[model samples]
Target: MTLTQRQAAYEAEVLRRWQDQSDGAHDLGHLRRVWRNCQTIALAEGGADTEVLLAAAFFHDLVNLPKNHPERAQASRLSARAAVDWLATQGFPAEKLPAVEHAIAAHSFSAAIPPETTEARILQDADRLEALGALGIARMFYVAGAMGGALFDADDPLASHRPLDDRAFALDHIEVKLLPLVHAMQTTEGRRMAEEGADWLMSFRSRLLREIG
Candidate 1:
């Protein structure tokens, strides 16, 4: 199948599986963006397998768990297993399954598994990109609201005098996790993109603080 055909098939499967999921942050659009980011990073970095990256990107969030779930850290591992099993049934290349699984499994920040392959690193970087910039801001607040968290600390929005608590304030998540992701990007291209996205996040935060004050 052509790359476009394969992408459409994968997306269809993902949508079928996620039909009941209520988390808008991890929806089909998010998966498509991750795949696009993977392709961009892979093109700049080179040597990544497109097929592996495509499968990994589409299936990375197969087992989407809530941020506050007790097994949130295991979601990526579970997703990898589920993805491999489903792909195996669909006649995907067996030799490439390990790479796809590793990419999906290592893509999660909470899982903390290191990406050992180029595809894995690209997937990790691509997924992390979703947690920055304009889209990141929207997802951050959406997730915070889903978890019953506040928008920001009224008096200490930037956490100057107090410790950052993302659970208590959605704005604190940019400092606690999003900004740090720029340095955490595995590929050089990914880092460059992440830096831009992080800068945008910072600008948004500045605007938000100014408005609140």
Candidate 2:
């Protein structure tokens, strides 16, 4: 099959896999959101191989479970191995294997998938971007909602460490996760986008606080 054909098949198969998941945190919807964000980053960054970029984005979080779970599920790596193997057969040259693996491995925040290649870094940035702004708010709330009752009642731990259930984690995410994305982004372009997004989150969170007070 052609590279395009392989990509389409891979994407459709992953979507099916995502839909079959009952997981709240790493659902198919999360995959779609991250993939979209990746496309945005890939366009801005340019120069990196597009096929490697998209495949990395699409498969980044395949085996993510609870944040507290082990760094990489053996299963996660295996799943990636399988995907990589399939890609190899589909005209993805052997030389490109590492690039695909690099991007796929580094795509996960959970996996400690260090983004060595520019492609991997762009894919990582793409995944990170989804967790900010209005998209971020909705995404957090979605996970918070699925995680159970605590995500709502849970307050930001920076204010006070109140045992940090799902709720507390969500709150800490504001200051720890969302607030610092601007600095965490690697590329200047990524950082610039993150800065604007961070401001949006800050202002929106402020509104929520004022209304509650």
Candidate 3:
């Protein structure tokens, strides 16, 4: 599908802002992964504007500043604000604003804003889909290292029975969140990709456990 001039401009600016806002392991790279996943899924879903979906996909993680950082759990509405404002400037329909904002606002796993629209759901799934499989495994390690987390340890408190803090949560996300993502995808193609991703994670984790445990 084609994006109107407004939508095109809206997406481009959002990508630039996000690229500048965070980089590498922050939110920038993560946002691109979601955008890539959204594109993969959008191709199969049909009827959605690739650019608009890409716009939302790009801006989805635009939520939650680093002050809140990894796990402080703040509202992501501010993250969605820049995109919303630009869309308005592009003369994007006011009616569509909430849908876009809602998707952006809810994309965070922390915010727990489960997407309400078809676009939002796919966006949400795409972003989370990043946390599964091989790439997902790489991202988990990348973010953990970025946040100063320790390398694997059977005794790391992050692996505890849900009693750990945010630091632990970030480190332990591999087992707690990443592992289940394959089954959680909302699209059929996403599901297929997730299966491969999740399986790689499972095998990798199994080896880690056998050796590390």
Misplaced by over 4 Å in model 2 are 1-4, 16-19, 23-29, 70-79, 149-169
Cα deviation of 130, candidate 1, in Å: 0.7
lDDT of each: 0.93, 0.67, 0.67
Which predicted model would earn the best TM-score?
Answer: 1
Ranking by TM-score: 1, 2, 3
Give per-residue lDDT, candidate 3, residue 135: 69
- Count backbone overlaps in model 3: 1
Clashing pairs in 1: none
Output the better candidate (1/2) by TM-score.
1
TM-score of 1: 0.97
Error of 2 at 73 (Å): 6.8
The runs of at least 3 residues in candidate 3 whose Cα sits more than 4 Å from the true structure, single-residue gaps closed, are 1-22, 26-29, 67-72, 154-166, 169-171, 209-213
Return the candidate ranking by lDDT, descending: 1, 2, 3
How high is the lDDT of residue 138 in model 2?
77
RMSD of 3: 3.8
Each model's total of backbone clashes: 0, 1, 1
lDDT per residue as tens, model 2, 1-213: 565676577678676655755665565666666666766776787778877766666666654555444644453465567567766776676777778777776666556655788887887777777777778787777666665534434244346645434454565567756777777786666777777788888898778777656
